[model samples]
Target: MVIPIFLPHLGCRDRCTYCHQGYITDVSGEDIKARIDAAFIHRAAPCDVGLFGGNIFGIEPAVLEKMFSFFEPYRDWVRAFRLSTKPVPLRDETIYLLKENKTDIIELGIPTFNDAILAGLNRAHTGQDLFDAYHRLQEEGFSVALQFMVGLPGENENDIENIIRNMVRLKPVYIRIYPLVVLKDTPLYTLYRTGQFRPTAFDDVLDCACRIYANAVKNGISVANVGLTDNELVRDMVAGGHYHPAYGFLVQSRIFIRAVEIVLKHLGYPKDITIILHNADIPLLIGHKKQNIMKFSRMGVTVKWVPSGNNRGHFEVRSQKGSAAGSVQDIYDQ
Candidate 1:
């Protein structure tokens, strides 16, 4: 298990268009050390620690060292450290400090590859900055993960394609996809209030996210997460954008339905079929509120599912006419 210690805008130089981490995180700066101590105290065993919220790379090297010092007392119980930050202003001194510490993974937030979108978000960094930081981290033997956002102002399908292409090319250890949510008091929220920025339709944003996620899986890059964690603060602060409690599940269900559709097409649109999959994936196969089953019914196909001990992401569709076996990866391959 990994313990998350939220810094909550601790090192951020400037806020992104949609970022209001103070509300999302609800973590106070004064309680950081206390939070660390409390987390380690309840640990049953050594665990990985995640330093989340805020731009860690933007901090000065000296202050960064002082920040790392807080965890020194719990070094024995700490397995490794993972931190998230923007890609720019990644100084060599910061890289050396991360290496000296037990920080093994660095998650860079690269919202988009389009320079115009980056400027619109006020990220103060370019796509090239992400590439440079990624290579530098790789040279220092650090595992890299990427964080991407969808549904930003002025984003388009081509931008989503760009994300997929770059993700496949860079091949980070894992990735997280977040649909943009305009929070109260942020610039994005102001635009939403003034009707200056209008988010794309919810389904359209979800489809865009699914394309990114599917491409990542097909390329053998792990997708560690798909949406922001749901909480009361998030629910209250959400002013616009694609914020759903079951956003991740929705993406998985869409991918699963796509895979089933591919298999059915290969089977000549069978009238009846039994889907054999790992027990854990039943929810995805059934989908939220049985939507997948309803979709099959609407397509003039009868579907039944049986749990199997087969590995997750593995499924077989058998019909009277024929049978086809495949996974989500097959969807992209075809």
Candidate 2:
């Protein structure tokens, strides 16, 4: 479990077009210690304490020292510490400081690989900067996690594809996929008002996110998150774009349905089949409203889901007539 501390927009010199961090974050500067103390008091030892939301590394040196000092009391009990930062140059001293504080993970926001898109969003960093920071973090033995947002201004299918391919090559231990949301008072909202830009259609972004998620899974990279955290603040501020409360679950259900269809195709339209899946995948396979199962029923397919404790990805498709064949990985391999 993670105990997250939000810094909001703290080290971001320039705001991205879609960002409204001030509205999204719940914790403020005045209550940072109170929130931290409350979270730490309830959390048990050996859990991750994450510094989320802003560019932590970009914080002033004195303030960074103060923040680290705050965590000093919990150092003996905290299993690992993680922080999110922008994809910018890092000093050797920063690495030393993080290492000294026992920070195990560093997450970088690399939204997209296209330099043009990056500039349009005013991210103030380039793809090369991301690569440099990633390698430097790894060289210091820090586990890296990458964060990407889909449906950004001036992005296309090819742009997203390039990002996934490049990210796979980077091979970060974890990744996050956030679909673009046009928040109130952001530059992107102005663009929407002026008819200069439009957010990607919900279906299109969903399709793109599924592809990214599937590729990450196949490459052995864990997708830590697939959507923004839903809250009243976000709901009130949302101007437009893909903003589902259960967005990640929707994508997972889509992937599950696709996997089932692929297995059915391979089985030559078997009348009765038992799907052996991991115990944890029940919610995804069953879907938000049992949509996946309902889809199969509509297709005139008889489906039975059997839970398996050890199955992770190589699921067994067992025919009622005593034939078992095809795994989830087989669909991708073909």
**C-alpha lDDT values of all predictions:** 0.89, 0.80
Instruction: Give the winner by lDDT.
Output: 1
TM-scores of the models, in the order given: 0.95, 0.88
lDDT of 1 by residue, 55-110 (tens): 88987798778777888888888899999999979898998898888899999999
Alpha-carbon runs more than 4 Å astray in model 1: 23-30
lDDT of 2 by residue, 1-334 (tens): 7778877877666778888888434334446666667777865667888898777777766666667777666776678789999976477667888888888999999899999999998989999999999998998899999999888877887887887888889999999999999888999899988889888789888878888888888888899989989999999999888899999999887877787777777667678878888888777777878888887788887778788864665466678455454444443321
Cα RMSD, each candidate: 2.1, 3.0
TM-score of 1: 0.95
**Model 2: how far is 225 from its true place, Å?**
1.5
